[model samples]
Every structure is written in C-alpha cells, then in structure tokens.
Target: MIIRILFLFTYLLFSAQLFAQVIRYNTVDFSGMAPFWQVESSLIKDTEPDPDEWNALFDAPPYQILMAGGFSQKEFEQQLRLAFMPSMGSLLRKELDKNNPKSNFLRHVMQIMGNEKKLKELQANLQKAQLIKTALSMAKELLPDSFLYARALPPVSFIICDKAISHAPTGVIIDLLFSMDFEAYVPYFIAHEAYHFYRAKIKVPNLPGHNQPEYPIIQMLTQMETEGIADQIDKKKFFLNRGPFAGYEWARSYQHYLAKSPQAILQLDEYFIRMATVPNSDSKIIEDLLPMNGHPTGYYMANAIIEKMGKRTLIQQTANPFAFIRLYQRVALKDKKHYPPFSSITMQYLRKLEQKYYLPKKAEQPKQKSSPKLMWYEKDKVINNW
Candidate 1:
C-alpha cells in the first residue's frame, strides 16, 4: 500500500508539470464568469459596482467572449434559470448576499469554480493542446497553408454551463456542471469546441436570410459540418485516443437501436424540413426533431461528408466550408444510393444558396468586401443557436 501510494503521488506530480508546459492555465475568463453570474443573479446584490471594473471586464479577453457571443445579462439569467440546479441557485445566492458573514464575492465564486475539477481538466486540455500544436507544427508547412494558421492559440475558459459545452469565435467554454468525469473526455470536447472557434475565424458567407428557404437547412448543415471537422481533427488528423470520453459506453446503453444506418439516422432531420424553412418558425419545433433518434442531423451528415472527403481535404474545408457541401454533392452524384433522403432536399436548395450567397450577381455583392462569416451560431438574436 505504501509503495503504491508513493508511486501514485510521483505520477500525479509529473503529470501536473507536463500539463503546465502543454497549455498555460488561464483563470482570467473563468474568474470573471463568477462575478458576472453574481451580477446576473443578484447574488452580490450590487448592480452598481464600479464602472471601471465593468468596463475593464467587458474589455478583458476572458469576458470579451460574452459580447462576441452576443450573450447579454438578461439572456444569461434566463439560461441560469433553466440550466442551473434550483437548490444550488437559491443556496448560492443566499450565501452570497451582502449580509452573510461568508459573503466574500471572491470566496463564494470559488464554490462554483470547480477548482479541483478544472485542474484535472486542465491536464486533459493540455495534452490535447499539445497534440494539436505538435501535429500542426510538424505538418504546418507540409499541409496547405491558410488564414487559420495565422491566428493565435485560442484561450480556453472553464465554467459552469447548463449545456455541456460551447465554443465562440473568441474562445472555448467547457462546463463543469454536466456531472461526469470532466477529465476523461475533455480532450475531445476541447478539440471539438476548439474547431468551432477555429471555424468561426474563417470568413465564409452567412447563410441565406432567415426568410429564405435555404436558411435553416444550411444552418443545420453547417453545425454538423463544424462538428464533423472537430470530430475528425482529434480522431484522424492527430490520431489521439479517446482515452475516457464514455461516448461508446453511452452508445452501448441504447440496445433498442443497434447499429443504426446512415439513411435512417438522417430521416430524423427530415421531420424538420418544412418547419425549419417556415418564416419565423419556433426553434422548439425543430428541437424535438434531433436525428439518430437523439443525435442532431448535423452529426449524421457531417460524418458522411467527412468519411467521404478524408482528413487532408477536411482540414482544407475548415477555411472553406462551402467545399464540404459541394464535395458531398459530388459524392452523391457518384454514389447516390447510400446518401440519406435529405440529400436530395439539400441538393434542391443548395443551388439557390450558392447563387444568393456564394455567387451573387455583381450588383448584389458588397462594396468594400469583407468576407462574410457563417454567422449561424450567433445569429440575429442574443442567444447561441448551437
């Protein structure tokens, strides 16, 4: 027992050092999430905190994601009401009230910070970051060069989310509240979200206007494509092991639906085809229409596209996502039998999309042409579409 304990301690000590070098721990963004939550929850009860701190926080990298993500105090509160455990919400606020003896805002912030949990996650993310960086560094010159390589390493922020996780154009946010082995699958989650961040930097044209028939379909496709790229990045490009993501294990729990076919997997999205195209259709209408009986339609289409294209092309597709759709269409031409029925639906609308957005008439194009980004995740509303 004594020898085992000693060995475990040494292993942990070495692991900690390895993490520090692979990816630097960034607390600035996460630390702000707490105070920002206080500001939102009335926990601190000081809506009138110093203007300077507010301005600085809004300006800060850690907090800049809020604005970049289009999340406001009102929307965040709504999410909190929906996402947070009710007991914890009430308890945390009461503990943080000014009259409480233990109401040090910073101290209370630590409660939800998940410091120890985050530290373990830090190790996982570091290993992932190292893998990604090493692969990119080794293959940077060998691979096709693009604007993605020109960008700096995106900062990672750990926080509590009602949802499992999300990434913004600015950074990746991993939630500690999902109640799982935050470390086991964190590498994949980080890589997945990081790819979202990376793709956001790419200057693709926005999907067709909301009223356009093509809008919702493309939005769904782009999400799946983004997920596909993230999935492939860690799995194929870097060749990293899943380690402990529990995805396969979770898949095992559903014995009722064994080995679902691609065609069936995509049929789920077809339920929303009309609803998504309708002007001002409620988002909830399509929410129930997730594919694979549970996975989003994006997951299925993205996998099909990625499997057909392979890694090298997929890497290039990050800079030009239109290529994914175009390439998928070409594959459909050659192998029409395997694609889902929705492939036909997309093929019908894609021509209009390419005409309206990608190949607009000269009169329709912008003057001082800044490339349009795929603004699906942070569309017209303050909410995150993903």
Candidate 2:
C-alpha cells in the first residue's frame, strides 16, 4: 500500500508539471465564481446577502481583468444585477437588452438557481485541474500538427463568470451558469476558445487604415482566417468523438451550419468579385450573408487546403492570410466544380494589396504615373477600387 501510494503521488506530480508547461489555468479567477454565485443566489432568494462577499466579487481578478480589458463596467454590472432583479423592466436600460423571461440571460440564471444540485456538481467539475489539462490535450490534438510552430500561443487566462456570452478577447471568459447547458461538452468549448488566443498571435502586415476601402476586406480576411482555423480545433473533434453531444440541439445546429459552408463560400466569392470590380465596396453585405461570423465558410476553405495541399501547407500559410488566400485559390481551381475560385480580377487586386502592404517600410519606393497603355483593370484606381 505504501509503495502504491508513493507511485501515485509521483505520477500526479509529473502530470501536473507537464500540464503547467502547456497551459496554466487561472485558479485565482476560477476560485471567485463560487462565492459570487452564492452571494448572487442569496440576493435572488431575497435572503440577507453578505455585502462583503458581493463587493469582493467586483474587486476579484476575473471581474477586474475583464474591466481592464475594455469590457464595459455597466454591461458587467448589468449581467450580475439581472440575477438580483431580472423582472424589473426599469432596470433594462439598453435597447439590445432581451428582457424576455425566456431570454438566454434569464434562462441561464433560472437554470443555475433552480438546480442547486447540478450547479454544485458543475462547479466541482469545472474547477478540477485535470479538466484543463485534458481539454488542452484535446485542443493540441485537434489543431494541425505544425500550428503551434508558426507562432507562440498568446498567454490567456480562463475566467468563470455568470454572463451567458462566452468570448476570448484578452482572456477566455466563460459563463459558469450558461456553460451548464453544454454539460459534458464544456471542454470542447474550452479548446475552441483557447485556439482564438493562438489565432490572434499571427501578425497582420501593415495595411490600409480603417477609413480606406481596403480596410473592410482586410477585416473580412482576418475574421474568416482566424475563426475558420479555430473552428476546426473544436467542431471537427466534437463530431469525430460525438460522445454525449451526438443528439444535443446545439451540436445539431452547429453541424447544420457546417453543412451550408459550401454555399457560404460561394456567397463570399460573389462579394469579393463585387469588391474587386466595383469601387468603394465594403464587407457589410458579406458580413450579413456569412453564417456564425464566417466560421463555416472559412472552415470550408481551410479544409479544402488541407485536403488538396495537405495540413502542413495549410499550417505554413496560417501566419500569412495573403498566403492563405493564394493557397485557397489554388485549391479551388483544382476542384472548380465544388469550390468556386475567386476571379482573376479579385486575385489581381488581392496580390497587389498583399505586395503593397507587405513591402518593407524602410525601403522607399518611387511612385510612378499610370502608363497610358495599361489596361483599365491594371490601373491604380481599378486595382485599389478606392
């Protein structure tokens, strides 16, 4: 028994050291959630709340990090206050506020409070150090083998909170209450959100300012590439494993959108053509047409690259969106029937933009007058579409 216990202790110590090298969970941020939830529950139940505990949550690392990272204080406070008085119509100040009792915010609060047993269960499960290690292990497995080689994955903290919306801006802020809905699939989300921080590390070349017409295209390109590659990290693995989420509604919907990725790509091609041919075209219409912030569409592109050129090529192109576009163009041409290739005009415009932006800033270039013999499309105005 003594030998077995020593072996187990040694094993756990080594495992923890290994996990720490890859990813670090912010235990300080996670530790605050349970206390906040308790105080929130007391307030919801009309019981006397601990003022000190309530105040402490606001000062906690999770709350402070979000506020420091530009998350609106009003919005953060509102999310917390909703649990205290969800039905008070006067409290709903924002036009975007979904005050319906069945709204996601209220619904999550209802779920969290209505099932004390489940909430406690989830809190215990989510706080486990093993869960982070396992989730990150799954994440590394899902990502392209050379994905991490392109750039260092940005440091990110995992924050647990009551807000239904989960996002990775500076840190990955997860909703403890809303996450209960995912149940066993929460690890999948953890992997997905963590990939975004990795995606953000890929630097964009110096490009047009926001006021320039090219700015919107740059935005669209970055959005698609970032979310597109990251989506595969989770969505592909989720389907492959299926686990308990095989018949889940959210899972079904996610797959449903993924199936429409082909159509989404064709739609984006049409938008790019307009931007290439027409002057001053922005990405708003394309944004409206794309599903789930260009995840499915971008996934289609990334998957196509992997299928035709191989994952290593796709991984190599991950750091450069311009290179990613060129690679996608190559793949689309190889299988024209399935993936519609971007037009020559669009390709030309993209190549020119890439060259102009990526040129060394220190090397001065002499601007020349447009040659009289140059074709209309070859001219600066047509190329820039400004």
Candidate 3:
C-alpha cells in the first residue's frame, strides 16, 4: 500500500509539472522583460488600464475584479480551461465530420490540446507533411505582403462574446487568440483584415461628392470587395494544391450543409451581404433575418466579392477600395440582374446617374486653327467666322 501511494503521488507531481509547462508561452521568448503568461502584471496601469491586460474569460463580477488586477498563471489556466475547452471540443467535432480518407485523428487530437509540447510536435510533423505545407503555403502566398499595426488595441477573436464577434488588426494577435481555442471559420478572415490594413496605408481616390456620413457604408463595401478578391486567390491556391472539390469550397459547402440541418451552425454570408448595402435599415431587420447572434454580414459580403473577382491579380492602381463596385454596378445594370437588398437603391441611383452623364458626344476642333499661329488680322478672321 505504501509503494502504491508513492507511485500515485509521483504520477500526480509529474502531471502537474506537465500542465504548468503547457501553460507557459513558448512560441516567442519574453523572459527578462516580463513573462508573456502574466497578463495583468505586465499591463501598464493608469486612469485607463491597458486593454491587453483585460481578461476576456472573467465575464462575471468578482472574477472580473480579480482579472482587473491581473490573474496568476494558475488562475489564467483555469479560466482558459473553463472558457475554451468546450468550444474547442465543438470545433474539433465539426472538423472531424469533414475528415477525408487521409485525415489523421491523432494529429487533430493534439491540435485540440494545444500544449507547448504538442505544438512543437505538430510543427515538426507539418514540416514533413509536404502536402499540407504546400496547401497552407499557397494560402499564405495569396495574402498581401504587408504588416499592419493598430495602436495598442487588445487582440480579439471572432468568438461569440456577449452576443458579438470582434477581430483584431494583426495576424500575430489573431494567432494568439486562436491558440486560446477560438472557433476559426474561414482561414481568410485574418488575411482579409490584413488587406484592409494595407489599403489604409496607400492613398485611395475618394468617391466624388461622397458624404462623410456615408463613409461607414462605403468602407464596409470596400471590405466586401477586397474579401471577394482574397477568396478567389485562396480558391485558386487551394485548387492548384488540393485539386477542385478539396479545399475551401468543400469546407464551405460542408458548413452550409451543417447550417441547414443544425440551426446552431449559423452562416454569416447573408448577414454581411445585407450589411454591405443596407446600413440604415431597422436594427430589428438583422434580428428578424438571423435571430441567432446577428450574423456578421460584413464578413459574408467579403466572401461573396472574393467569389466574384475569381483568381485575377489584385489591382493596386485603383484609388478606391471598392473600385470594383463601379464595375459590378455596370454589369448588374447591363444584365438587369437583381441587386442585393442593401445595394438595390444605391444601384438604382447609380443607374440614373450613368444615364444622365455617360452619353456619346462628337469631338469638334476650334474654328480658328488646329495649330498655334500669331494672327496679325485676328479681328478680320473673327468677323468672317462669325
């Protein structure tokens, strides 16, 4: 009995050590400055505390107060387990459902745990899995070659928090959020946002006579257009590596199937499409349209635009982000296709303007002369011409 007790105690000690090691951030070293794991202690406190220090998991009262001061390693780990594990499990189950003949269950199991040890092993194995590396590599290639920095905003994820989803500006921040077991839908979400950041850096031409109040609506439309471009790039890369019917489209179709059968798997495509075109509609329109967490239509419209742009190179010369909006408008007008609810009225207005201004006119030359000449008798020439 004494020997058995000793063995059990040793086992417990080993397990605790392993868990502690797993909780430590191992991706990037930040040892001397401050432990990356110590969220609150490292935060700059003042009249307004640093948002990065804020604990997303402490959704309740006293725990929220505890989080405000910052949490210990043990407390943070507990919060992570409580807040993330179940959601991660759900995501894992969904991924499993889409498993192909080549899918490895053990590999996905390790991803779910996401421990430092497991991550190292996964990285090593990914190096060996040439096919997956190629696929992911292709996806990376489609992204714009620029990094974006938003001054001091805390990293956020697309997870449903208090009935809303938020995104951060940087990919590194996004990767960290994903590490915390946030549900990842489309891989392009990070890449798409990054494109927006890139667009912001360059001077884009403004819409003539466009009102400032309409900026939000136009900005969302621009995001939709860029997202559509990225989607096409992703699709092409995915198809080239994995073959048609193997990549994002397959995942998208599978998601659609799940959404239809299980109301819980809500799709955001319709929501974003509406948001891009209709900013002033009653708030209840969204609630009525997608009773579940007001489906993010912005994200959806981005996806739709990507689908339309196909696999062409991204146009860097265009001044406006939604330069394609004009093209889409022209196509829709010419074809007489149904415009999305948000765009319907806008399109109608554009059509009227196009008819008013876009008309044919014959060019005429000056009656005096085609070439410059010093006319000594300009009075006589003018009188004769008149």
Score each candidate by Cα lDDT. Answer: 0.45, 0.59, 0.34
Worst 10 residues of 1 by lDDT: 1-10
1-386, model 2: which lDDT tens digit per residue? 00001001111112223223434443313645656677666667655556676667666555655554454655545555655555643553442266453244444454455666776677777666455555566556435565544643322333344343434343345556555665555666666665665555545668789887677677777778777776676666554236454455555655677778777666766777787788667656766766666666778788888888887777766656678888998988888988778778778877877787754557677989876786766788776885
The better-scoring model by TM-score among 1 and 2 is 2
Best by lDDT: 2
RMSD of each: 17.5, 13.7, 15.6
Q: Compared with the true structure, what per-residue lDDT tens digits does model 1 show for residues 1-386?
A: 00001001111112223222433443213444444544434423323445554454354444344444454544444333322344456665665565442344223234443344564455455434553454344334223466446555455555543234554434455554332334444454454544554456666465567786555655655655565445443433222233333244333322123234354435533644544365355543433444433322334445566577665655665544356666666655666687644455545555555566655366665578776775776565545444
TM-score-better candidate, 1 vs 3: 1
- TM-score, predicted candidate 3 vs. hidden true structure: 0.38
Q: For model 3, what is the alpha-carbon lDDT of residue 185?
A: 26
Q: Tell how far residue 11 is off in model 1, in angstroms.
A: 38
lDDT of 1 at 239: 24
The deviation in Å at residue 365 for candidate 2 is 12
Each model's TM-score?
Answer: 0.49, 0.69, 0.38
Candidate 1 backbone collisions, by pair: none
